[model samples]
Target: MKKPSKCQSPGDSSISAKENDAQSNRSRDSKVAPKSEGLATGLDETEWKSRLTTPEIVLKEIRTLEGVSYYHGMVARDLVESKLTRCGDYLIRATDNRIMEFEFILSFFNKKRIHSHLTIKCDVEAGKWALGLLSVNQFSSVVDLTNFYKTNPIGAGFFLKRAISKGKYMIAHDRIKYSPKDDLLGTGNFSDVFRGKIELENQMVNVALKTTKLLDDTMDPTKNVKANKIKKEMIQEAEVMSQLRHANVTSFFGIAVDRLPILLIIEFCNGGNLQGHLIKFGDRIGTNERFLYLHDASAGLNYIHAMSITHRDIAARNCLISVNGFVKLSDFGMGLKVRRNESAEKVAEDDDGKENKEPKLPVRWMSPELVDTPDAFSKMSDMWSLGILAYEIFTNATKPFFNLDDTDVMQTVKSGKHPPLPLSMGPDLIRLLKDVLVAAPTQRTTADKFYNELHVLCTQKGALSLNGLTINQIRGISRKRVEHVTYRKLSYAIRMVTREIGVMHHRRCWLMLFGGERSEVSSRTGSF
Candidate 1:
């Protein structure tokens, strides 16, 4: 298993020849690749083999198939259907979807303006290959099978079509070591983060193996299309991650497209995530110590925000704890690279003004704008979640809105209120939270300001006091308090009651004026 630092065509005869030999050894005498994995004593062979990209697989199969001009591996079916016109116009494309038993997928544009995909499979027992089921004819090899189908109509009255192989997408894939089932770190809807190892430069390095299953049902056009899209995004994610460099930001090792499920290798944190650390030891931590953790995270946040990348998912759970007990932000599944001249604040301007209404989000740490429609995550959303992260630290990771249902969390956000931080926190810290937790994106404190202030406070409490607060600065304590911290949520309740009372008083005044005036006028008329 050679890991190249750069991209190469896996279809190269030499590369395929070597890989084919290795693959054959793994399978007992079967000419085709084995579909399942069997346990081995030392390292898992499947993990290493999964590093083999699509072009390698196709080249291995067609190594001896004569007259098959070009091998275009792992092409999207949509591109094939649109480009190939006329009935019987056909092309062969490999799929990253691992489920299909294949020589290749035969995509033909039918007369009905639609495409039909027929799986080409091999029967190891007969040592023959066939196209389409219900066909009685079987050929000695895939080349012969494809030749037979080219001229003869199966059941659909279809005739021979040109075998077209378009431009191939080839790239050098990196390497990843197998992560055992027991070493799995976490899971997500589209990807899983495994505690795994990879060889970097010359030495072994532990990494967060973020992977999505590429070996699924490719027969379904929708599923295959989606799998490919995810692959593209994974590649794009790697591109974005490469630009980020900061001690507080989790380091990206590289991405591997060589295997069935592609790999995005990230720096693994040994102390687990900040959320877990807070839950276990937050109560025991002092204010200054907690500020140090927030300070570390803000430094990372400040760096990425400057890079023009929006880490849509930012929270205590996403923030990993390093061996030194510092906070490093992780998890970029929802991250999007901001386009040039585009501001993250403007991206969140909703015409409908809808907030994320999802009853429950992971850890319930999402910004208000993101909660309604996941698509509307603004660039400034990182700050919103940072505020939540601060709360998690202050509260020692106590679950937010514990008394409120998840549904109420959305409602709470809609009403321009958030689950408050502890009033017992230092006044300067409360004021800082006030600056960040605001609903308006423009009003929220900038990451630069947040990080700078926190950095100062971490060294000495109330060190961020301004010129106006010289007395407090001299005392080394912030006399300036966030007066509303204790009564902010109460003000919301008070506002509602006062509004009701004002409406009642106005209604009574209007009724009295109308009734009293009419009675006085009637009495005067009767006396006259």
Candidate 2:
């Protein structure tokens, strides 16, 4: 399989004639030099032959055929565009329904001119009909084209079928199912979580969904607030998640909004939250396990930050562990869209109104600015929270700010005081903690820089002794907590129901005594 040469000029017939001879080995190859028209006068026979053999030309011809579709044409276009001019290979499907393999050897005569010689072998037909060019650029480059086809075979197939059926390309049909089971995941005011099957598409598999919720409850209607807020948050989160198609981040399935409870169905993580895992397994989780969770969390956060959104709440609780050991950042409730022009004055004003009646902020993990003023939130603040989370994970669920009351913590934060790293903590971690937990927001490290530094610390040669935790261990801890909390609420409801029954009986007796005598007297007077 000799490579094809690049197209230089019409007069440059050496490579073209050579390519024709090579292509003729399998089937008879003919070179036709039609006179150049108008602006194409400078174009010679070789240039014209190159244009005819070009992938673009082949793709265009394929589109005109009855079976070839627009999407396949696009895929073909991408495959060709990405090819190097000199070293390219392609699989051509001829107009007469035969496959021919060819390679192009590219060379540049001048900056403006190039030449190519195509070596081809016809697998089926003997003579040339209308040649449909599918050029291969290099050996093993087929993998690149294969990957593209694998990702978009359905799309291409749909385009082909659509063009054939309708005589023109139309919108492809979306057959994604949206059902009640798909609507199980939801985000709350304080937490973002989801409950759904892990494998909704094919088999029955259990999975839990995770996300952050940031919508103000004061704005949503009371009766339908939670559902409405969850729905809206899910929609927005899905939109954002859809844009972020990364392996480290959670994978998004099709969403179901037509039902009463709108669901942003996602692949469930059977392993619970990191916070619960540490509390349950504590000393059992090795250093490497710890680093794994941290690494995955950092990767996910880095991706989020890259998309210009800060995961404001980066805690163990928000880091979800899957049964298969995959870690994903779940809650997006507290996440904020990074703004370019966030003024300090505007932040101050927003905080001023909420001074008297502010929601109880998580003091221990909160950044100094948040404790000092409610509106003092930024990307730096999120980094501070991440630092606190890392500290919690490292310590195996020790109290975030132990031995300090909320007021004292607030006061200390206001005065620019921060908790010191434990003596046992490694230098890399200690540095990370100090850098993120700096009192001044301006001085705090950015998420991007933090992630890069963390990656180095984790991957570096024995910087810190740590390993990653499995997703199941993390989930086991979190799930137990959720179950226990649920049981407590259910028990409370049962007790309340029993007490209410007795009270209702007493009230009924009292009503009968007060009204019974009056009713009897009225009946006797009617007779008189």
Candidate 3:
């Protein structure tokens, strides 16, 4: 599958390693109780070792002990007794030979020095719990409380507070529906994207479903393991996104995690990506529209930066245009959060910082410092990419360093050269590009500074009014107009201007006006 490029560009090794170390320390400090409770004395390990371990053992134990319910509804008394005994919670399971039911009640100390309780239930019919039930509390269904307790033993109280508010970020596989003929939208290396319809708020709406590539059984075991690892990373990325709510960033609906080929449902963009939009409607796109797109992108980048997140892949290709012309940043495959206190300069100097095995980065958009000093990556790197994106927007998405190969491009960038700018770009924008393309991390503009300048530019042009339909939405409308006003006007003009110019000359002119290779336009629209 064709996945949008994130260009690896792993964070500087020192920062990442330090983050890993810090996480490891937290994990060590927060000791969780083991998830597997010991058998009640008599049952040996062999007897408990069935094809299914957890549910079977839990079923047998609950059946033997009888239900742990009280005859009286003496809430205060139970709280006092539970506190005295340090038995703050009760988990119960029931079965009627054919169907299984689980109920878990957790009690915690509230701020008023009183006990509070939360109850979660799960039911499974036949053998397909994954498809048969959608639990009211998704976390309870998705996370094993026993395992959670064990993992966060020291931070049990803290974890509980956060978990209560967090939704379960999983979607059962059966709920996802897509067909190549009807729903396929695009593909990427890591996943395939499809336009899907799902029930939300008692109505069906179009959603973009992205599914990861699964390992083939016949593939080498090592490759399979790597693929699984990649899938896990994508899931983790989705989990982070699920918590974010922003206008500039793409909205993540949820994810399907219970089976192979995991799926992520995101808000659909009818206008496709920024790069495609620019290519399709470049000639008709006015300066106002282009600035509007830039403004939207800047706003999204600034928001993410404020949240301490770095969208490592900042490019026109990764930016999506909604039908209303609003731009939303998408593709979080290589996205990561850095601690607010972490200095970009310090991260640039960490040990094991020069490893060539880091993920592949789009060389043309990379900052010189990032290329020269491996593991020197920072948000400044993304800022540099934003500079390239600016260049892309002004030039109709023409490739950066179009004449150079990857190796040469890196060397040239390291030598402090940037792509040649079109002479027509205004001084303000050229200056902005210079600030973003500076070789020193400290010299580059911060997201806030860039955003401020964009606002200033808009203010100067009296284009400050952002009606909120994104540039992409405007482009979509313009595309529809092509067959009506735009096509007629262009066709009439072409016929008039080229009346004496040869047929071959007319075709060449048409190709130039449309912004694509002759062969491509010919194949799609047929020879003029």
Report the Cα lDDT for residue 258, model 3. Answer: 32
**Model 1 score (lDDT):** 0.53
lDDT of 1 by residue, 1-528 (tens): 212111122211111111111111233322433443321111255543443333333333543432244334344455456657777777654443333222355677776766777666544445555554533666675567667777787557877577764432222222355544556786443345778665445555566766553323222533444445555566667766755545577766566443344556677777677777677764566665577667777877765665556786677768886543446788874334222121222122211224322112442566676655556666567788888888888897876666676567666765657677887568888888888888887789988778767666654674332234222222222333211122222323433444556744433332332221111112333210
Q: What is the C-alpha local distance difference test score of each model?
A: 0.53, 0.42, 0.50
Per-residue alpha-carbon lDDT of candidate 2 for residues 1-528, written as tens digits (9 for 90 to 100) = 333332222111111111111101122136643433211111234533443443432222223331322121111122222332322122221111011112222111122223222222221221122111333322222223323433332122410011111112111112122222234343332333445443223444443433322222222223232333334454455555544433345554434321111234444555656677788887877765666566667666655554556666667766766544555776553333322122322121121222322223455666777754555666787788777777777888676657676667667766766666665557777888788888888998877677667767766734333233333334242211111122222323433444556634433332332221111112233210
Could you estimate the TM-score for every candidate? 0.56, 0.46, 0.55
With candidate 1 superimposed using the best TM-score fit, by how many Å does residue 49's alpha carbon deviate from the native?
A: 12
Question: Candidate 1: where is the Cα deviation over 4 Å?
Answer: 1-94, 97-174, 188-190, 213-219, 334-360, 462-528
Q: Give me candidate 1's TM-score against the actual structure.
A: 0.56
**TM accuracy, model 3:** 0.55
Q: Identify the runs in model 3 with alpha carbons over 4 angstroms from their true place.
A: 1-166, 180-182, 213-219, 223-228, 334-360, 372-376, 464-528
Ranking by TM-score: 1, 3, 2
**Decreasing lDDT order of the candidates:** 1, 3, 2
